[model samples]
Target: MSIHVVLVHPEIHWNTGNAGRTCLATGATLHLIEPLGFSLDEAQVKRAGLDYWEHVDVRVWPSWEAFEAELPRLGQPYFFSTKATQLFWDAPLAPVEGTVLVFGRETGGLPAELHERYADRFVSLPILSERVRSLNLSTTVAIAVYEVLRQQR
Candidate 1:
């Protein structure tokens, strides 16, 4: 079994590409939920991912609903958000097989309906500065993915 990094309605190709790189490094599968803002063939994405883009275990979904329909009941599903009260470190994450880490778009975070549905699973990375609203989408994914990896080790 492998960990999964899910990006729902991602708007930037570079972020997705960088996330793919992180997934590749961490042995996690990358799932993209459309409609995407940029085409996967875009040069910018390739530039960001370098030569490793093709090596990513990427799966593209038509929509969030479609992705959810086929979601595997791995270890546990954790949603990363800036609005969540629980910190990622505070979550009871273990390095179990098939752990799923879900992230949202760069501009809007996760949909409101998803928040309502998976309220308990929501986790946040601590931001001490009031000047920052949220971290970059790719950065958040990397942090969350490593957290799971660390716990499991």
Candidate 2:
């Protein structure tokens, strides 16, 4: 059983590092689609990941097209976005192979094209406060991935 966490066009290294830590904890593979905002060697990133960076099974993609081309080999990917009408809990997150959870940039949710293409797979975490825009990227990934672990166990 494996869970795959994908961060597309991620802008913040700290979030990415933190997400990696979550992936490490959950036995999930971490895939990063590039044009990254910060270097992986940055001190802050290392700080966030701490001693666990070496343990993370991380893969880097050159672009969205490159990553999308390899999607078939990866497995069933679900897009997480604030715009989605479906709630994350509604998804059948069975502990299965090639289960990819894709998240977008911090400020912007996901590319409109992806949203349009995989609209049915998109799910959102409910935000109780009207003033908040969205949850932290790492926090979202942790929550979503854990849900998969919960269901599988």
TM-score of each: 0.92, 0.92
Best by lDDT: 2
lDDT per residue (tens digit) for residues 1-153 in model 1: 568999998998878888999999988999999988888875866555557888889999999888887775555788999999999999866645568889999999999999999999999999999999999999988888888888877
State the lDDT of candidate 2 residue by residue for 36-124, as single tens digits.
88787747556655678888999999999999998878778889999999998988866355688999999887899999999999999
lDDT minimum window of 10 residues, candidate 1: 41-50
Q: Candidate 2: what lDDT?
A: 0.88
Clashing residue pairs found in predicted model 1: 95-152
- Give candidate 2 regions above 4 Å deviation: 42-49
Instruction: Please report, in order, the local distance difference test score of every candidate based on alpha carbons.
Output: 0.87, 0.88
Question: Cα RMSDs of all predictions?
Answer: 1.7, 1.7
lDDT (Cα, 0-100) at 140 in candidate 2: 96
